[model samples]
Target: MAAPEPATATATSSPRPSMRWRVVDIVIASVLGVAGGLVFVLWNLAYNPVTAPLEAFLPGLQALFHGVWLFPGVLVALIVRKPGAALYGEIVAASASVLISGTEWGPLTLLSGLVQGLGAELVLAILLYKAWGLVPAIVAGAGAGVGMVVLDLIVWYPGAAVEFAMIYAVSGILSGAVFAGLGSWLIMRGLARTGALSRFAAGRELGSRAES
Candidate 1:
């Protein structure tokens, strides 16, 4: 008797458009966004207190935690694997955060979310939304981190010294790369293992790995 064929064919061969967002996509995306937003609220409250020691150690190093705010973009992009997934997820999360918990930046938080989400979205677009591997995920996270620091420089720290700005930007990139990129990828793999994402390629890939 022949062994069972792997279920990775549809993912590898399907055209991009065929991966358009479905109802489930919308539902799951919304859930991720809302949950992420709640996390953002809690993180917001804890941000200054948690980072005070790091800031005292090195003024701009607190940006190391910036990735905490950027996870939804990377996570949603990996899970949804469609155009605007990152933007939609991050934007929704940001908006929800504002509505539910309020943020120091007020409406500007929405803009930050949009731009950060765009950063990851652009990376995914460059990959043609076809790849969900570690490299792409890291790139996407770095992109968001870069976008984040740039926005912060303009809006929150316009008068900050060049050295401070530079440190902030670099720290943000590394943090986003690790926390958002690597973290999201790990979370996705875990979800896949649980069979919660069985309908997605991510889950199928995990299954393929196990069978190998």
Candidate 2:
């Protein structure tokens, strides 16, 4: 009988992500960033009205909104699969928030966004920017959440209680998981389903799965 083709060879023959950036990637990232920014603006507007009562009842509830600003960053990073994508997306959203809704925190919000975006970006970096699997997504989300807690502790809530701190941290992590990690993953999946991401890992994964 003829020798069977090597599985390794077959696997290697599969398509992989390219290092080069396309015009479409830039345009898509920019659009996602702007859309994320708009969402941030809307969230900012809604936060005060919606969370005011919660803040009055439980001050820790404020952290619930912390992760809201981070979803776009994750989404963009996942889609673009590039360095600095998270940071750019987040900063753009922060700028939009600032332009649309002036805050007493002033420039500090921008700084916070940068820090949080970097947190998630580092996780993707550690993964070598190759895998957007659930584990990495969760880790990225947790990283962003932890970043928010640290930032808040140092700058915004210096004298917070231990219980409140725990609550805040947990809330931030959960929010990151849901809003940033899984949310971004879902968006990628949806885009893949539409065949819009044929050039990326997300697209290839979906394509392979469909082929199987």
Alpha-carbon TM-score of each model against the true structure: 0.90, 0.83
Over 1-212, each residue of candidate 1 has an lDDT whose tens digit, in order, gives 98767867876795644667899889988999998999999998899998999989988899999999999989988988888999998998999999897656767999999999988888888898888999999999998898898898899898999889888999999988988899889988888899989877788888999999
Candidate 1 lDDT (Cα, whole model)? 0.89
How accurate locally, in lDDT, is each candidate?
A: 0.89, 0.80
Candidate 2, run of 10 with poorest lDDT:
12-21
lDDT accuracy of residue 65 in candidate 2? 66
- In candidate 1 the C-alpha lDDT for residue 63 amounts to 94
- lDDT by residue for model 2 over 20-39, one digit each (tens)? 67788788777887788788
Quick one: best lDDT, which candidate? 1
* Candidate 2, residue 118: lDDT: 89
Clashing pairs in 1: none
